[model samples]
Target: MNTSNMDRCLRAALLGIGLALIGAPAIAQDAPVEDAAAPVTESAAAVEPPPPEVQAPSLEQAYQREFAFLQGQKADLERRLAELQDRMGAEQSELEAEIRALEAEVVEMGGEADRLEDRVFESELAVDTARENTDVLASTFLQADFSLAEAYSPDLGDRAPAAEDVSGLFDAALGVLRDAGSIRVEDGEFFLIDGARVDGRIVEIGGIAAYGVSPRGSGVLAPAGDGGLKLWNEDTAEVAEALAAGRAPDSLPIFIFESTATEVEKKGTKGLFDVIRSGGVIGWIIFYLGLLGLALVVLRVVFLQRASASTSKILDAVSGHVRRGDASAALDVLKRKKGSTSRVVSAAIRNLDRDREHLEDIVSEAILHESSHLNRFGAFIMVIAAVSPLLGLLGTVTGMISTFDVITEFGTGDPKLLSGGISIALVTTELGLIVAIPMLVFGNLLSGWAEGIKDDMEKAALRVINQYYEGRARGVESA
Candidate 1:
């Protein structure tokens, strides 16, 4: 029906025709030979008569032979088709198996891709967390605002930190801790914003605190606005020693900076008088008491000095007149002399006519009288000396009470508010000591001088009396 069937029929017909032609040729040749042989054989006898019954192949016979030939060719074509079909089936089976294997591999690859995506996501999250932690650690562990930490910190951009960056952060934190514990003296140069430079061995106490020991002097280190180190105006020997020895002494407090904290060339202009003035009214009272004591001291000193000279001269004049046997002259000299010594000597000369016992009695009275005059106002000076300190103490107590009142009203938070009372307490006490020491010392000295003058006057008066009695006895003996 189809082209395949048509082609098969054509092939069969062609084969049949080819076979028929070949058979026709053989038949023709056989017929000619038989005819010839029969003719010959007819002459030979009756044997040829049965051969003459043989005839040419009918058309039906030829068709039968051609059909059989065509059938054989069809069988061969069918066998070839069967072979081709079998080979095609085998190839199809192999292709299907390969396709199934490829599908399974694709599924597996998809699963693997999903797992890789998840892992990548997790890795990204971990990196983000690590970056956040690093930032917090950098800010907390190291005070970022401080110059030292700011200098050491790395400038990471917006990206998260890698594994290496995290490791570096840990290293930096460890380094900070190590620096905090360890002490070192380094020879370095420090610069200031104002173009000041210092060359010295910087004593680093962890990076939190720094001090420098230089040929110039020792001082604290402070950070400038320009992120450079500037030596603070304040310094102490104790701090320098501690830094040099790599040991901090107990009770080390914060360093007190100067007026503006930047003025290194000059200190604040506060004198001792300012300190005293800071003490309020109580301090002023204490100060005036001290002045009064000083005044008394000066007056006592002047009086004692004058008494000393007058006593010496009076004794000399009276002794000379009595030794020359001129009692009236000695009395006149005693009257003319001006001092406690002269007064006492005049009393002794007036009673020269009396017996030695009466003269001694009169001289004793005169010496006692003159002793009072010599010691006049001496007690007032000592009292002033003693009272000045007590007044200062009163001021100190009052100031302390005032300070406590301030504390009760407000806490000890503001030193400025409390400083007034404290200054008063301390300054008054200091002024009291200042006033009391000289007063006590000079008072005792003036008292000693007064006693010496009194003693001198008494001795001179007794000697004059003795000489006068001796002269009288000598005159009696001569009579």
Candidate 2:
């Protein structure tokens, strides 16, 4: 049967064999004992010992029977085991085959699923592409309709077809484009420059430009902040008339406009004063400070010029006088001469009788005194240079503050409101830099020039002192 039934039968056969083997020896022993215990049962003993064939089975025979039975049962169990093994092998093979079949089916399904998924993905992609193309078409139609409406008329009305009618929209747009390219004259009323409305024949060269030939005045046409035309310039009357009469003018005086709903005013070039005014009060203040700095620079230049005048000639004259041992003449020459170099040389000459160290001290003192005039306005000019940028920074801070204030009040909707403050901020800073840079450069240059003048004066005085001493030495040697 099955493995479980075969296993039960094999266990039962083994248990029976074990019981027979265990009882066989006890049965043989008991039979002999019983025969002996019978005492006068000699008849029974004799009857039992009558024949081996009629005697009870001995333990050896019983064991041989049990062994034979056990052998038979073992043979039967072995046969059943073989049948179970064969059945199990068959089942295993069938299961393995089934498993393989299922695995193949699963693999096939996986490939099919992959193919299906690819197909689904492609379908989805196609759908998305179609949607995108539909959106593009709709947007194109809307844009075309809007462009046509804005260029030709305020409302498309029946001229613009439905959004779904793409061909109609394109056809209408093309027609409008063709019409716009050619000059078309139409009877219309337009406003003159003096705000008087007059009937006119409007000559439209294209969507970009138009010209009006009115009874009152004929010139180029511009948008009047309404769906109407206005006289832009009276000088273009000839061109407007030529276009109206279907004559091509040699020159086109055209006022190009994008829309008739908004007026475009020609912007004038701003002068220096207008730009400065746009910077507000701070900008004006910076401008004035720049002027002040410039004036200071000029004053310092004049002072330095006067202080440095004829320095070489003064040195030569004093040196010649000192060389001749005419100290008094040298002093007279110094007195008549003007400028820092002459004064320094005079101080050296007056102190010629003194010791060398003392004469040098006098010359240095004279040079120092003249340096005050040479350094005049230099510090103020530098101060202006330093202050101008700081004022600019202050103006910048104030301007930004005002800009923020405007933003806070108006919510930054109109850029014009914010531009004023921004312009002030930038203009003030620009002006400040413009003022500061030159002032700083010139201030440093003038200071360096003043230092150079002082050096020259010291050199002139030293030359005079050397000449005086040399002359004295010669005079003393001659004596």
| Best-matching candidate per lDDT | 2
Query: What would the per-residue lDDT of candidate 2 be over residues 229-336, giving only the tens digit for each residue?
Result: 889999989999998998889999778888898987768999888888988898899899999989999988987887777688887777777888788988888788
Q: Per-prediction TM-score, please? A: 0.51, 0.69
Lowest lDDT sum, 10 consecutive residues, model 2, at 152-161
Model 1 clash number: 0
Could you give candidate 1's per-residue lDDT for residues 129-235 as a string of tens digits?
98788887656434632533633565555555467766766677677778767778888766433556868777766655666666665667655434345666444
Error of 1 at 288 (Å): 2.5
Candidate 2 global CA lDDT score: 0.83
**Model 1 lDDT-worst window of ten:** 257-266
lDDT of each: 0.72, 0.83
Question: Cα deviation of 447 in candidate 2 (Å)?
Answer: 2.5
RMSD in angstroms, all models?
38.9, 7.1
